[model samples]
Target: MKSEFYCWLANKLPRGLAYWCAIRVMSHAACANPAQEVDTLTPAQCLKAWPK
Candidate 1:
């Protein structure tokens, strides 16, 4: 539900801006400690499921 809501909100934003932001957030996550385990898929992964 939260992801759906956020996606709906993101649809209100410019496509270029949204894509740029997603890339930045994913890059930031990639920079996180490699040893750390993510309990769930990151937002970037979820965003990937969306159609461009």
Candidate 2:
């Protein structure tokens, strides 16, 4: 992602410590939802399984 995007996200978070917290939160969400095969889970199930 671009630094400008990061900067924008950082600013959108509550000022101060919340900025770092937001980064951590985003990282955790990404880690929890690592990319995978959409077909493996079946079509109806895949929507719930994958991140938006």
TM-score of each: 0.49, 0.38
lDDT of 2 at 50: 41
Residue-level lDDT tens digits of model 1 in 1-52: 9999988998899989988987766655555634544445477664564446
**Model 2, span 1-52: residue lDDT tens:** 6989988976787676876664555555555556744234333443344466
lDDT, candidates in the order shown: 0.66, 0.56
Clashing residue pairs in candidate 1 are none
lDDT of 2 at 8: 91
For model 1, the superposed segments whose C-alpha errors exceed 4 Å read 1-5, 34-52
Worst 10 residues of 2 by lDDT: 38-47
Error of 2 at 13 (Å): 10
